[model samples]
Target: MRSRQFGPRVSKDGVSFRLWAPAAKRVDLLLDRALPMQRRDDGWHAVDVPGLTAGSRYKFRIDNELEVPDPGSDFQPDDVTGPSEVIDHGAYAWRAKDWRGRPWQDAVFLESHVGTFTHEGTYRAMIDKLDHLVETGITALELMPLADFAGRRNWGYDGVLLYAPDSAYGRPDDLRALIDEAHLRGLMVFLDVVYNHFGPEGNYLGHYAPEFFTAAHTPWGSAIDYRVPQVRAFAIENALHWLADYRFDGLRFDAVNHIFGVRDEIPLLHELSAAVGDLATETGRHIHLVLENGDNRASMLDSAEDPPRGKFRAQWNDDYHHVWHVMLTGESAGYYGDYQDDPRGDLARALSSGFVYQGKRAAFWGGEPRGEPSGHLAPSAFVNFLQNHDQIGNRALGDRLESIAAPAAVAAALAVTLLAPTVPMLFMGEEWGSRRPFPFFCDFQGGLADAVRKGRRIEYEWAYSKYGDEVPDPLAVETFKSAVIDWEARNQSPGKERLALVRGLLAVRHKEIAPRLPGATFGEARAGADGLLTADWIMGDGTRLHLIANLSASELSPPRTRPAGKPIWGGALTDRLLPWSVLWSLGEV
Candidate 1:
């Protein structure tokens, strides 16, 4: 559905163009030559140039005037300002046709941002580190959004060209190569996509069809009008485009809670989820659909019997992170306020159900009722992570967990994230505990750049009053440079130690806990005096895994000595857990 039917369809010898501008009286194909298009039965304008070749740049002239990049452009090599290039979607020769993708349950995601993941910060350069990721036991690579924005560096939430890969990361084929390499090496790759709003700069969608957006405003920008047939088609087309054209296994939709003013039903989100299911069935590929919705709506992943056609594979479990963050850092700020009291129960709820809120009134929701009941959901439905791009990068200093919490505390959290019956995601360089600070950085030049800088300064003023001006300006090049990972650190002493910890934990998980994930999981969590949280998971197969974690800075009660239980990872834990520490034992009688 990508290039074969939509966008600029490049055949053996010519280029055919199509546009869906019901508002436009006339739209022409403008490139090496201007060609008038005929209005189709479906209200789409279409024209074909018999001898036009690939690599030529083109754009659509709307209403005999304003030229904008194609809404489904494959390659915007010259970025947003220039013409969109013609590229055949079937051009690349893929080497991993046999790569059927790993099972969804075996997914251990390593969330990476291409711009800061490596010094080169290109798709090709990212491919070079795939082996390191495989060694770290990451079965799937989850990239931050790669959609073309206005400039070189961004967190990628602000994307304008939904169909075009960011040119800063390299050409279209470069991205295809990275995916192909990952597949060949027994790793699956997925992309993060922003569907709620478009970027402020270089957005040309509204110029052609103003009806593409609505009066509703999201936190980032203008909300899309899903009720409009063309708008819904535009979004759904973009989703299938990434899968069909780019071979992306699936997508992580950013902030569906901001997609619309929610009332009763999420029609567009459900429709997109169903569409993904259809695509997977059609292609015979294992596709996954994940959401980062703040509202833990159970309907998002319900069985096919339910309304709204719930079929998503998983969602980002922020409840898990919130509980751990407050416990480990004693932070009662912002959203953390919701979990400050009796956090151990919340953690237990996060473990038992996939969501902590579960239709309860949350303090973070201004003491309002939020989050649907999700207690019936499977544990694997939650994507749990201790250090994701948001948890670290949203801070005043963009500090990782290592900076704010003790090593023992960090390890305790990692143990839960890795060993529990949940989908675990590791942020880039997390295994080696890289010190690179992933601050919010964007190259929104001129007025927008000044606005971002000023806005960041004002937003973090309270933090500055308390912690000083150590918060790097989001618009600076230095901030972007500072975030790039130093690949050499993985071999160093401390880095190697962290790496070994992760490797051993994952090894144990694959050997012991993985088999139990498919079976019934019975878990019990208890909060003791002196900042201690104890959790035990007994599987249907009679394999029991116990965790005693101390989130405090000082040591708690002593632990009992291990007789014959295998200790595969992390630090020691006897009767009492060490301060900020956890102990895991297998086959304990």
Candidate 2:
């Protein structure tokens, strides 16, 4: 009820259409033909067209000149530019009627992109791969954004129709089927949503309501005006639609730092949290909200107490990824420079506490203080990943770290990511070490096509100029095709080995570590004279777990005294660790 029902409100008897276009002098609902709409006092236009049921496609004829898709389209069956369709969400018979979803304490996430996740690149095709997800020992599947963007394929971040699922992936029912299957397989589905800037093409919101976006800046062009009432309502309502209508387990809020601020910002997140909290209580389902913030706004995390009350349940921790990436690859760029001063110390801090900056002046921010201390937060509130869509695709060539990092070093990073006390999300194809590159790819309209092509080159303008175009054309179909996971790799040499290692580590984590997440704690990573990074920590079961890794190419001696508990994993019990190796001990050392 936060947002006024903006789209067609489906009914057994006809349908009622409403739209807010305060700027428009005339607005009409154009179905088979035009039906004039009466202007309302609340800056909205209303029209009740009888004999219209679900699946009836219609466009709002604004100013009696241009007919465009609904601002709150439930489904864009044809594409982003197509007319919006009325969908009866109650039509489908969903499975898992009794599933309450896996909680944060036991969540091991699989972050996947639907288009490139499989050969077919549809929701039905994605469901076919659920077996691998279950085999990977992940409890949740976090999909990249699926909102309707322009053209046939995209990263989904450029989505304009915020409520409609991408038609490229299949109809609304297909997506629903996929979620149902995932739930049946005991995998909670989380959607990544972009609420910052609308994609360039076919976004008609500004045509009707120009106040949707504000003057604030975001990494993705411009910021959304969270200060506007209807805007806030639309945002919150969209979130609830996903949670209540589609029955998703949670949402991975993309780029939370960009979504609000420059005004009373916290209220947006607060109100959303309150609403979702209420929805959970009513449905007897726990719907989690996660934030992605480079600044680590740990203060926004919901409390650790029972029936937790507050904002988001967790946040993606970039500090962990930044330090880990540097430690393994020794490649530091951009914000990574801040941790180069004491990578191990920073890693240690990230391990023990959730944030490394903690209200201190950030060297990356030109010594401006950022990110309040997160020591008070529970470890589960910090999501850790060695590789994600951005870490891999943002590269000029979209090369996975596995392509460059030493095999052993990659394995060590994987172990740390999964074995750590925090929530872990595995990028698609990461487990089996698929050699495919996940390059940035998109399909845009003609005019925007050239601009997007140029934008890709200019995204890292220096690379395009200096490296002489290190990236492939994002507009090319082959560029998208090349990113698909080679399923054959799972049966081959190094890929098989990598798969075994990943599965083995996940098995160990699920059995020994996952249950302890609610109480697990992390300490800082300390370095020894031999260049080995070591961290001794306590698990939820009061058992001591010691992590020691040799990231260098040469073999090194182990600790003077063995780790507490027996070596549950790795060569921790031995005196020497092979280059780029790690040891995880469980019993007293």
Candidate 3:
């Protein structure tokens, strides 16, 4: 029988194995027999185990004191910290042979937690929901973090085991099955990965080796030492493993602001981007890397050369969501304070420039000014959303946009998100106006769980005391259960109406705007001094579209330059649009 490739398959004759051990002076790869790998000039230890079969189990001995799992392990069955299992990437029976990658611009993201997206909360159960998403016109699905986390019921963000797929969600093969099934249905899958920091529980990196982290402290705890050569190799190799082994089309990086590397250097962001790009070229597959940066830094859109654009395909535009939310809900606590007054200009700027805080001082951030995005980047480079896992789950009660705003306001926001220049995304329940509250919940056991519960309650109570209203306790089982979407509700009249409206808006976008895709031009119209704004898109084929919004409480007159042809949407042109109403129209200018 032919021997299988043991590590990353580079070419027919070459494969690479990497391990992360910063503190160790010497490291050896323990293959079928103990083999001392030669330390490379670049700080990685490697050996070509070409004759070794794919199912071989291996570990690493570092400085004669620690035997740790492979940092780039393809499989880890004996707990997350044990020895790794080498598997042939080509062995899995893939059913998605004709799978073509879904573009970031083509995606309508469905963000949901595996624990609550269905009653079973397993990968298999999620596979059953693919038909619904496919029919709903979503081309891609963004799953919340699913790395092996402690306990069974917590959100996947607190995940500690980066190598092991959560056993609770069914084994590694199960996740592969989920991706394969999704691809078969013409839906791309993007996994939300937490790289800036690991979760609090089952995190055995410290126990095995000190090289996994650095002296720097992050909000989540110790930061990964990306500046260290071995540490960088480990991070990059793990990302490659996910794409090559599991066939994930893309990765949505969580909290990239915390990824601090060497100053005056390319930084890990650019390094990973280049690495992923190289791998994509070799594999002939379209792979995307997205960043979620709270800091509105324009440098993220830079290319590989010069100032070095952060090397990411796209980054989440929080400013757009912040402006939209504040305008509709009229809430100004916390981060919303920066967008409290005259948010129409901010919204219009976000639609035109892709960043609302461009060179503007943020009030909530205390004199910190955000930079503008490079004008050359396409509209798809900015991922805009009014609701996401963070925006909903981080709230005191996890109230969705529909919970806090009127139905008309919610519909307007949806239209704006879908029709704007930036790529649009929708949170799971937002489409049907689901009443569920996606509150924060975890399954930490014993003292840890109790501490989390107490801490969450204290935090919500403090918000209630200051904000003038009590919020729901996050620890309550009812809170988490309430977040489970009522799939049956989609059949009802109100739910169907909301879904149809979204469908209509998306139909207009896909048919009219998206066909123009990267070359569409944008301009904005102001409705007097009250901050009511309208944005227009002129397609490559001379087709004109307009988005008219009334951000203020009262209606405003149309802009001075009215379209010459009949309005495609009559509801938007009617007099006196109530507070927070938005309309989309197609006509000739």
Candidate 4:
């Protein structure tokens, strides 16, 4: 049980390094050292290299056989597997002095991966693209996880080091610059973080601290031991560090269900939420916590007689997206089997009630019934999206919904998602209908790379056995490369049309509906025999809006007696709504 601290320290010439390896008979500073050296007492080994500056690559040579990279390496250009580099995180001059924070309820989030977002695959490169997002009416940006992982090229879910940002995206300062630039443009940034499990390769937390991981296993690897005092502190402290130091507006927790603790009374989620709230108050900035819970549990937001509600601002409503996807595409395979035929009913239920599975058995889950979200929760409490990284990447060929469905249907889905009762999110290039396939790919060292390939194949094989010939190998480099968005596509006719539709929908939502409701009361739609569904939404301020959606492919005019005298902002009568399309209008009679 020995502790080792290796990092850049203040020195006249630069910095010095010291490590602890009591078990080893010998230790040496591998930076510019041709030979190994002996260890000292007090379980400490020291080395002073004045000329070795930050970004210097180094490793530790222990017992002559083990040559490991610096445990605190700031950059790993060669591979995710090797040693670390010395980096002074404090060296960067931050420029986001005037930035406060964006409120979660009002945010329009855009999710993107750093590697594919730009050709350079650096944070600086992403900073240059912020203007496009800002102009597109997006209020916030959600970056995919960048925690230190096994390779320079990865989706980042396989991150092994929780505290370190991926060096492939440039140094810590580069990230700071990106965030600062985004803030300057009035865009709040939310980082995706994984706390459920660590990737298999380059995971050395167990070696550094046995309590860092628990015996309980996850699909990825060992589950973090939140029950242990040290482990609890580590998780909380790591979260606080990102917010306090990096100035990130919020965090999107990867898979919170797996963050299990033995104690029933004090769940790890409660503790994490409390910590985030305290930090937010102390910093005088609003910080949001979002969860990616597939279980559809309502208690996730409930903090009754407990610590502050699991500091989560919202959770992804997968049921809503799944139902919408199924209805639009009419595909029934994998988990979507249950969602095939009856989409209108499920969608209507999800809109009026927060949970679509309320008291209904989940055929795929093989469960009794899932609980519904409390009435107290606002529509903003749910983050809705038609497609995300997983939905696209998990496909056999990693085809996005836009690619599978007709252009008109895709446009209609976007309109429906934007007008829905939840906060809307769009994956990169989704608004413009980018045809790129977001495939699952990895770059790991040695035999680990092959293992990742095999694992991905097995998962997709089982999921898409019906389309055996269509399935693309997840390990193929081309599969991952093809996922990158083509910047040139933004100017095309179809892209422009799709972008305009999204802009129109968002403008209506923000300008007319959002201001009126603040928090509106949702009413179920009563469809006519002609196949038009109509609902009445009354705002908190008594402003009433009558919405009529034509869900069929053929155009059918509503009766002349249908709530007349209301100044219609827009509507589609002769304009046929390709099956699955929706039309929303706002005004008072």
Candidate 5:
């Protein structure tokens, strides 16, 4: 029953319009013609128009100079640069009205980009594939950001209208149907939201309310001034709107490390979590929140408590991915350089603790101490993955690990990641080992388009020198099409084999590990110089989950003592582990 403060308020009586524009001297509500709005002392513009109902389109005129869509617009039918259409949030008749959500422990995430998920690339198109996910054992679908951006083919990160679900996909109802269908199938849908910074184009807040941003800049754009009370309310309300309006089961906050304040204060992240926790309590829904923070601040995660109240459920464990990548592909560019020296050892640490850094001095992080002690947190506090959008798209060729590394190695890595007690995620087509590339693509025009092209080339100068224009263009239609996963591959040769492997791993995870995840505690892990890895975790039911892996391409002799548990995966204990071999077992304590 909470009302949004920034957008049109619809009721049986009429619609009340409100805009927070302190910088603008005068504001006009644009329907058929401009109507002057009454300016409040609190720097808010208000106007009431009776009989203005849903399906009506409107915009705001600032000082009779520039007209802009509502920053809180429900739907941008004409994209981010056009007029906003009024939408009734309560109008949708959800079929799964009784559905609350699944527990965090049951989550096996499939992170996807809606635009490139299918050949049709629409919300309705995605629904047809929900059964595929269910059969593949993906209990949760984590979508990339859906906020309206300037172009038709963005990764959804350049969202300018925080409230509008990009019209390029489909209508608001269509998106609702996707969630509704997903819930009916017992799949929890979580949205990836960007609160750190707005996209470069189609953001009109600065024209009327310059105070919304600080002079400080993030890598994308100006840092939002969350210090302001109105600015703070805007973000919190946006989070609620998605959860309440569309009935999303949870949210994954993107790169929250960039959401910094000029002065030290209570973080907006905490406030947002508290608000969401209150909603979960009121609705009795098991809503979850995850963060993609580079800082690795273990203090923020608390998966120890059931239904995780008043804290984040988990964080994306980039450390786990980095070590695996270095060991597999031998690529040490960028952040990968940090793990190159002791990748096996780092992998051991990641298995034993939630973070590989854990307050250790990171050579890649400007030689500064990174991360906090996290061995005490529950094993589920980390979301482990082999690949995600950023790891793939940010590469020069956007090559998947299966494409660049040996298939056997990637499979071994998956065997370790998927069966572990920590929450596991998969990139869109990772289960089937689809070779389709997910190169970065956007639909910007003119100067902005050119800037994107040049920036990519500059960032990948080595690729530019060698490939020389063969590198995928971020603005090209072909680039977007190339990222569309080949669904047919799931039924083919090696794809079929890989699919079966993942399906079996997830089956075991849900059957054995999930029930015991509640009291799962971190156990010790050690990697020998001869490519032998020994790790274990104490499950909730007092069972010890054990793992032994030979990450190297050369076969290695086994440790003196065999794992105690009955074999869950891999064959019986052997004298030697073959190249890229892994073993998982659960033992009675």
Candidate 6:
């Protein structure tokens, strides 16, 4: 029931409209008719409409010429370019009113894009598959960005309206229903939010409030200037809006390294974490905050804190993914090149410590040292995954690991990832080995569409040369269609086997590993000369979890160190470790 400065505030006196437009000479509220708004100090324009209420559609006419949707509109029934619709947050009746969310250690995430999750691609449609996820042993459903974009389809990253949920999906209540249903089924829902920069199209802020953005630019667009109090409040309130208004279990911040802050000033990241932490404490909710920071700032994470205490619960461990990827696919281009030099060793480091590049120089990262030391953190501080949206979608062809890596090798990787003490995440269809390409697709039109096409072509020139005319067009409707996973595949031959494998692995993770993951400590891990990997960890209950893997194509001699306790996954310890073999065990420490 908290009021936010960024959006329309619904009260007993009706709807109060507010806009921050310092540069405009006059701002008018366009409802049934254009009405003058009082310009207050600090560039805020406000008007109290006594008769207006929720579901009222309105826009702001700037200087009597340009009318733009509210930047903080809760719902955009039309596309982002159309008029904004007022939404009363308290209107929807939540079914899971008592859902407080699950703990961080129990999290087994399945990252999904709601639009491509099913044929209908609506929030309500996604509810049908919730049972399948529960059966497959997924504890959490992590959705991609939902901020209103310019068109009918997008990856959801190029979101211009940070507050509004895109109309292409469904109404605001539909999304709430999805979350409500997820909680009812005991599944936590986390949203992937982009606060680094606004999308390229349908952004009208620069026309009126140019101070919202900095002169600098991110990889996507102009960086937001968070130094301004209003700009900072906008982002902070937006984060809370998702957590407080929608009741999401957690949030994954996308590309946070781009969100710049000064040393003297309290960084926006710290302030936002503090605000979220306060909410969690006040509400007595087990809210988790995860980051996708490329900087590998271990200082930002503190799993020890109950309410987070201005720190995040975990970070997406790209280092774990990169090393496994290099070992499986033999990729040596771009960032993958960093792990190619000693992939086995890198994997060992990732398995032992939280990060592989702990102040070490990375060849792919301009030969510069990156990441802080992360060995002291809890094992749950890193969210490990073999594949994610960026790892697959950013590829020139959007090829998944199962498509490129050997089947046995892929299975071995999954066995290690799923059973490890760290939290594990899966891309939507990975459990069923869905090979449908998740190519980068959008619904941009006109010059913006042309620019996107050209950029994709340029960025993937090598791919174009190799598969010319075969690469899916970024703006075509068919391209988006191709990304929709085949649900029937789940019941098919190999898909069933893969799904069973993941389910069994996760069953062990939840039963044996998750309960003892609280105070887990990292143990030593090493790679031998003959495709042999040995690692161990001490669980919170003082149980030792050990792993032994032989990743090469040929049989290798057993390591001097054998698995510790009862055989959890792979068959009994053999005299000779077979090719692509992986074994997990748990013993008393």
Off by over 4 Å in 2: 1-4, 262-266, 303-308, 363-366, 462-466, 587-589
lDDT, candidates in the order shown: 0.79, 0.81, 0.71, 0.71, 0.90, 0.90
Those runs of model 1 whose alpha carbons end farther than 4 Å from true positions after fitting are 1-6, 40-43, 261-263, 302-309, 457-469, 519-522, 538-544, 553-577, 585-589
Local accuracy of candidate 4 as per-residue lDDT tens digits, 1-589: 0121433353558667765455667777676664454457655566677666777777777766667655445556555567667766667787878677865545788899999888788899998889988778788899999888765678899887666788878878888899999999989999998888878888654553456677788777788877765557556766776787688998888877666552254467777788777777766787788888766666665312112335466788788888878866887777787666567777766666566775567777676565565445666667889999988888877888877887766776677677665678999988788888888877765677678766776766645666766666555567667777887888897888888777777777777655654556665556454446666655556665665666666666664545543433346444343354465655453
The total number of steric clashes, by the backbone 3 Å criterion, in model 3 comes to 1
lDDT of 2 at 341: 77
Model 6 lDDT-worst window of ten: 258-267
For each candidate in turn, the TM-score is: 0.92, 0.95, 0.85, 0.85, 0.98, 0.98
| Candidate 1 minimal-lDDT segment of 10 residues | 302-311
* Deviation (Å) of 202 in candidate 3: 2.3
- Model 5, span 477-521: residue lDDT tens: 998999999999999989999999999999998898899998899
lDDT of 6 by residue, 1-589 (tens): 2458988999878999999998998999998899899997789999999968899999999998999999999988988888899899998999899999999888999999988999999999999999999999999999999999988889999999999888888998999999999999999999999988999999999998999998888878898999888998898899999998899999999988887553244478888888898899889999999999888989889886778667899999999999999999987777887887789998999999999988998876678889999999998999999999888987878889999999999999999999999999999999999998898999998999999988877865644557777778889899899999999998997999999999999999999899999999999999976789999999999889989999888999888656567988887898988999998888988
Model 1 TM-score? Answer: 0.92
Q: Model 3, 8: alpha-carbon shift in Å?
A: 9.4
- Candidate 3 global CA lDDT score: 0.71
The per-residue C-alpha lDDT of model 6 at residue 539 equals 93
RMSD of each: 3.0, 2.1, 4.6, 4.7, 1.4, 1.4
Off by over 4 Å in 4: 1-78, 262-266, 302-309, 466-470, 516-518, 525-531, 536-540, 557-569, 572-581, 587-589
Indicate the residue-level lDDT of 88 in model 5: 87
Model 3 stretches with alpha carbons more than 4 Å out: 1-19, 22-70, 75-87, 262-266, 302-310, 373-376, 450-479, 525-531, 552-556, 565-581, 587-589
